[model samples]
Target: MRLRDLLIDIEPLRAGRDFRAAFIARTVSLFGLGIATVALAAQVYRLTGTTVHVAAVSMVMSVSVLVGSLVGGVLADRSDRRRVIIIARSAAALGFAALAVNAMLPEPRLWAVYLCVAWDGLASGVSVTTLMAVVPTLVRRDQLPAAGALMAITGELGSIFAPFLGGVLIAAWGAGFAFAATAVTTALTSLLLTRLRPLPPARSTDGGDGGDGEGDGHDESGSPMAALRFALRERVVGGLLLLGGVTAFFGVPVVLFPELVHTRFGGGDVMLGLLYTAPAVGSVLVSVGSGWIGRTAAPGKVLLAAVLVSGLAVAGFGLSPSVGPALAALVVVGAAGTVYGILEYALVHHSTPDRLRGRMAGVLTSQQTTGDIAGDAEVALIARWFNPGAAAVFNGLLTAVTAVVVAVAVPGLRRATLPAEDDADADDTGADGTGTGADGGPGTPSVPLGTGPAPVAAPPRAPAAG
Candidate 1:
């Protein structure tokens, strides 16, 4: 293959300046969150000297994020998306600032840390969902995969480097400096958000074609519960979610890493840390070289293949007797999982209409969080019963089987294809200050800002049924 074909595609960033801004903002914000994560863990462990207290804070944050995602989804569909994101991120910035202040205190209170974590988690949940919903609007439909890949790269980079940076900062100046740094990054994200044009909710107001009140898309609006109902009712959407849930539920091998390192590999702390980081390294390599992801017509088939590969790789890891082979297996697992994730994100965005995008994204986020938490518990229990390797092998096989089952059950998803790009289009924005449609249409309908409500985009056609 050519070098260009093996590199990360930058077409989405080149498509519009707004997308560029969003991309940079997302990268910054994710890195900031990652840094905060390390600092939070260290501070909590220092204050309480118990892992249970750390877990308690994490649980609190998880619940808050869940609740915030639901509420944010509803608000995104009802209000101006840009406004909601700005407000949510600004609140998170404030929370970070508060954490900075608390860290600087002579006697840091554990309660203050918990409160700040909860606050940040809730705000992050809201901002992230709204941002996901807005991304498709900033680029052409065909650029979705590239956008997804780029976003995935940001996450991988953050996971790999932000903790190291956080540790360095803490060692040099203490946790207060790290917290202050995060606050600055959060504030920068909010500032970047302000540069984007107004993004009103795409749901129509009247009982018209895509109206939320009472029409064709009537059932689309309202709370996240309504969105959940819609997802279960929709064939392809439901199928995708089902497949994702299955993979997530069986995909956690991290819980077994400690036992495997101890008993199977006879390794210490350093080796265990290497095992934990191997997947992230693999994910980053694949994501950075995902240029072909956007050009593929058989994305659904590729996604299924990725899941199968991931399962087999995990099984291979579990079956490995030596460290070298085990690390290689984990690398393959990470690469395969990254492919699956990029395709899943693009497919979800492609399938969902603008009006319901936020709610659907929220649902996906919630499902992932819930699945990971549950999977950790389920796999840990299995390992406790049989053995770590046995649990890994069983879960890996289960995940592979789930992928095969989904392929057979969801034919529509299996045959899915992205919309074609328009060669004539230059960018998402017109010189006249109007926005263009994402579906290769001429221009989105517009209303003057401050005159009344911002104009909503016309909803696109629904996905093929499974």
Candidate 2:
């Protein structure tokens, strides 16, 4: 439970100047993006006065992101990730600039807004896939869980403050300024990225064996289809991706909450902001505790528990009568859900080899994007047919279903082990760290934990004291 030890574990990855700069840049960018999300939603609602239009905008962006993620993932596998990231950021900045400029026009054009959003979505898709894919390259394998936790922390920090701040900004200066601010932040992020050294190009297979550094041992001119096929066939990766889609469907209720507040609870923007913050607070707490959990428990078990808790919490939200109870339920749901998110990323990182990491990340991102789109659409349709409360209930049920299915189908997932810290002392660790049956190789197949084998090495240890 030493916080200092947890922090130091990730220090080696931060040793490189490029990595640190990129981290800071992304952190700032995320904050700005958070603000922009709130501002855009608020602005769009004010202009259109229709939830359908807002949902439509979201759907468009989601589709764009899905496409970009798939394309970017393939490119990342083939090219220099550093350059790909820089280009994507630049495009994102330009897209933000378009939004800012569009906001200032005499008559705001909805089409223009949609166009900017589409471009922004595409850029973000590419950026996200590249960044996730590149993380394994920056840090050692054993340090990945900590790095993933750090990432969750950054996102939670952004989520915690962004909506509140965005609301305040919109109230004071309007959406145009918010868009301009996002543009400035995007540009600054790109500039910060420029300070990093170029990443080496990804290795090509070129007739070499699949051993370390020899390449993925595939043909250099391999079809793009190869990446997709690899992702689909990899046991660990495929299961995680399916698990991700399930989580997305279950989680859609959260996005629909603002409409629920407006329609059912008779609340406005202030309440909306508070509603958003409820889950975020829980996510922040979980992110803070993730390092400790990663240390002792099997990550897969942790993931399953988180998903189930999140599902039950969402159901609780449906059962609650008032805002207070709903908020509390959201808190639980958010915390557990964030843990699920971290574990999902960890699985993707660990399951894929280094060479195809980018493509794998892209596929995961695309699946997530598609899931969001589908989930939101489902919620929207349910809301149209029934009440917002019914939609929430349905979403909760969906989560429950996902948890059960994952519990049953993905045998490897149920008992999947966290990547143990590579410490010599950790060789005999089990799921609960109580010792016994803790050999480094994969754990026995279990029902709730899924069928993926346990990691083969001792728990990864923190870097030796300098």
Candidate 3:
């Protein structure tokens, strides 16, 4: 209720040197990736003068990123996480440099553009997953919400401005200059990562069997499939993953924006652009005022509430007869979506153990990408079959209904809470899966639903390139 509760918290950056470096590096890297995305699309279009060719390049990049994320998960759990990030980022920087050189040439080769983009996409996926996995090791359990809020802000900023900046650079100078700038930012990220302390995989952070289940008889920690197996056994994690997929599949109706604008509002290019930017503007506002998120006792409840709000907002956008109301609805959609994303992020990390964090992060990254891409296609098909407005209305209602269903079904998620500040090195979950109080007894109960036991400590409680 206090005014200070509304502001974004920067405690993680101030208190942890490793987190600070990673934050700065991540912010810069996100911008670079955004810039590269725009430049690559433009250059490919110019070279081939065909949208099909551009689509092909994008498909290639997506596939490469998918492959990289899976491989990165295994690497992150098996090797030094810090080294994984550094190597991945360095490779991306080199790819960007290659793109810059190709762009500046008298006759730029389209093949080279494809090759470099594929290379960059692979590297970006690895670095992104590894970075997400390593954050819990850098900060205390309670600081995760604040850290997630900061990450969301940076991602939104990149989404809002990086593409515009890339376009400006391309128009004023050339695509080559934009590519070169991205190359510099990525290289700088690699340099920043070098300052981090070596982070090795914790095979067993709490001396458990290193598995989430009752001795699954398989030490799957080093395997990418370990995340999948873990999710199957953990209902809270499974519910969270499903919540994310539902939001992505039914909540984000981006592909239908143009059709809705043209048919319902009789709008042109400018209106379309405004429609696109509205949600991001709303997201930035909420992220800046996200301080209260860290203090929430029932994060799972909040996440579900956000999901409901987001779905209803989208439905409102579909039902609105005029532009003013439509844009207002979109702003709400963005705000609610941001809240859901930030909470979901923190809860996932809190629930996961350090040993499987990397693989879990990779699974999340893949799930998000596949969800968004599949969701877009699904919405487009619905629009084609019926109408854009109708599609939005249906999807929005479906999303809202799914949230209610999840809240009722997943008690662990609904009851999940964050304990007050505990010891930095406290074991949140006991080996037998019970709450461990600050005095090493039962203090405040904050447990994830269906995860066997609540954390004795605190509850174990992207997507750009991810």
Candidate lDDT scores, in order, read: 0.75, 0.66, 0.78
Candidate 3, backbone clash total: 9
Off by over 4 Å in 2: 1-16, 42-53, 204-228, 262-268, 383-386, 423-453, 456-466
lDDT of 1 at 43: 91
Model 1 Cα lDDT, one tens digit per residue, 1-466: 7889879998878768888888888888878888888888999999999999988898888878877777777777778888999899899999999999999999998999989989988997888778777877776766777777888888878888988899999899989889999999999998998988888876443443223222455455676665555455445667778878887788858989988998988769889988988988898998889988767767878988999889988888878889999999999988998888888777676545566777776776677668878898899999999999888889888888888988787666667665556531443422122444442224432211122222211111010000
Q: List model 3 lDDT by residue over 1-466, tens digit each.
A: 9888889988888878888888899889888878888999999999999989987898888778777888787788778999999999999989999999999999999999889988987997898788878876676667777877888888888888998899899999999999999999999999998989887766453344344333547667666776777676567878888887788778768888878777888679889888888898888998899999878877888989999999999999888999999899998998898888778777777666666777887887777767777888898898899888888989999999999998888877787765456543464432122233221223323244554335421112152232
lDDT of 1 at 99: 95
Residue-wise lDDT of candidate 2 within 280-329, one digit each (tens)? Answer: 78877876666665564677667777877887788788777888898899
TM-score of 2: 0.82
Off by over 4 Å in 1: 205-220, 423-466
> Deviation in angstroms for 452 in model 3?
9.9
- Alpha-carbon RMSD of each model: 6.8, 6.9, 4.0
Top-scoring candidate (lDDT): 3
Clash pairs of candidate 1?
none
lDDT of 1 at 132: 74
